[model samples]
Target: MPRKERERGAHQREPKGRKQRKAPSEGKERLPEDKPEANQLKTEQEKEVKLKSTVVDIDSVREKEESLALLEAAEQEDGLKNKNLGVFEWLLMVFALALVLLFFPFSIWFCVKVVREHERAVIFRLGHRLQGKPKGPGLLFYLPFLDVCHKVDIRLRMLKVPLHTVVTKDLARPELSVVCYYQIENVALCSAALSSLTSVLQSVVQAAVRDVLAQHSFSHILLHRRRIGEKIKAGVDSVACRWGIRMERADIDELFLPVELQQTLATEAEAKRQQQIRVSSCNGFQ
Candidate 1:
């Protein structure tokens, strides 16, 4: 009986240390068998996440490097700009100093003749003549802001005096032109007595022309144009003598009227022709 009870008790025995293996027909869940595959999958997923994090860190480092590189390049560019600006400033200072050295000394040497050498200054001061003081072909000093220098011929000077036209109380227009030759005898009077040398001569010559032409009729002025120019020379000689100038000659080279005067003459000739025609017709009809 005991032996039969022991055998019966085997079915109801308490399961001790070993877990029971489920039958295949009971459809057991095999969690332990699948654990290693899950662990391998987890390792692969972790690896992928780590790889993504490493890639992100690498991109961040690259971006920071690029920013640093760009900043360094910008600093270099700014450094170059500042360096060039400093060099430009230095060059400007040098150039300003050079201009002062060149223009100042050269302009000073133009005034005040060292007359032992016999060089003269024809100084024009404030639009007025200096009158007889010779300027320097040598070194001289002038009040730079106020004085201008012109050269005078120490030798014989020739000035062309144009011809003259006479318009008397009668309105008979005529041709006129001439030239005058003169030289500076006194440098002091020549410079001091006149503002412009040419102007004084022009005024004097014009006055002489008017005077001589006023004395003559149109035909006299036209025919004796050369003589009138000589007379003008005489007048200029007298005036220039006061300023220590010598008039070598006054000569008339060309005598002519303006084009409008020539046209008037032509029209007068046509009128004369028409008059003759009328006279001939009147005679024939008579």
Candidate 2:
């Protein structure tokens, strides 16, 4: 072939079986620097995506940790509250029991009594309907539950028995008063005589006084009151002997007329005195 034809044929028909690599033409040449720049841009974009994912993961972990800490804190707070409640219950129970234990001893003295010396304590037993024998001069224990004990003075007792005006046999009213003395004799009879002892004593005294006064006039009760007292004492002795009481004295205190009666007496005395003076003057004139 001619030389130009031979060059054209070589350019068009690549070497057989082995691919021919052609050098780029000058007008369409690729720059090696641009390839490296593109690779760096792609690597930078990948790094940015990875950084965003890491940030998300870190925030999630922090949130989880915070929630767990809060839950644990709540659990701890609940446990502390329960512990405080248990301590308060224990303290309250202990205090209540201590108060009960401390108060038991004082009740002994408040509900019981011991018999004393130089006195007789009469025991009133439960369900017996009768007073028990009088206990004297010993360290005797009283019943704390079933019996009550009372101190009975063995000494003589003096009481005032008053005398008063009554409708006399002479139809006159006289004022009077009296003093009396009495003592206990038969303890059993006295205790059984009446449930109300003071009332019983008053009844006996009044009864004696009424019986004795029935026999006397008003002047006898006021002037000769000594005899009246002796008679009253005798009457009282008869009654009190059975009631466990002994009569020692019956004495008068004061005797006076009522106001209306006193005025009448005074006016009558004045009129009688005036008449006597007039009679004396007339006799002297004659």
Candidate 3:
């Protein structure tokens, strides 16, 4: 072999051995540096992740607290409103109960009556007259089913006497009817004295007319009908005052004689008229 080739072969063999040892040492040194850098990078990433997690946790806790506070306030407001409503309802119920207690007995046990303007009420307790004369023409209260009320009219009324035959002083018979006008003066006295005032007035007036007609002659009665009516009115007024009634007036409405008497009277009147005519004719001739 040549000397230079041999030296070249030896140098190559020496490099292979040295390179294996130095390469391992250098790899070990570089691996330590790379491990530190990688570890630092991983730690920084974990810290950033923890910071993000802490921030999320804090926000969630704050939201929960705020919701709880709002709900509590709403519940407190509702409770207060409910308490106020309860108090108002209690007051209304109490007022209604008081009203019922105050007026209930009166409504159930008493009665109300109204009297018109043209009427008067007479009250009686157990068939006995009350102290007052008559009730007013307005509202009145009484015990239910215990007091009795009788209403009386105070307006004017008319009474007509039926036609009846009567004998006069001159022995003449006549049928007559009379009309009487009267009004109530005191309701209580009238109701107590007479049950039906109109009927009594008719009977009294009929008797009065018959008596007055019988006291005078037929001719005198015919002429003085007004005076007879006045006399009858005066007689009735004196007696009616005790019954709480006032006699306004009395008038003769009908006067009828027998048919035979009427015919005889008419014949006599004709004869007198004929005689008067004859006398007038004689005077004219003279």
Pairs in steric clash, model 3: none
Q: What TM-score does each of the candidates earn?
A: 0.41, 0.52, 0.56
Best by TM-score: 3
lDDT tens digits by residue: candidate 2, 145-243: 445666666567777645665556666666666677777655544554457766666667677766677777766677788888887786676556655
Q: Tell me the number of clashing residue pairs for each predicted model.
A: 20, 1, 0
Question: Highest lDDT among the candidates is held by which one?
Answer: 3
lDDT of 1 by residue, 1-286 (tens): 9999997777566342123444442344566667889999999999999998777565677567656644654453333231223565456546654654577666445434443343356665545454334665576555544556665566666666555555653465555566778877666555555677887887787787777777777667667767877778866775666565778887766767656768989999999999999999999999
* lDDT values for all models: 0.64, 0.64, 0.76
Q: Which residue ranges in model 3 land beyond 4 Å of their true spot? A: 1-110, 269-286
Report how far off residue 268 is in candidate 2 (Å). Answer: 3.5
284: Cα error in model 3, Å = 18
Quality of model 2 by C-alpha lDDT:
0.64
Give the poorly placed runs of model 1, Cα more than 4 Å off.
1-151, 160-166, 257-286
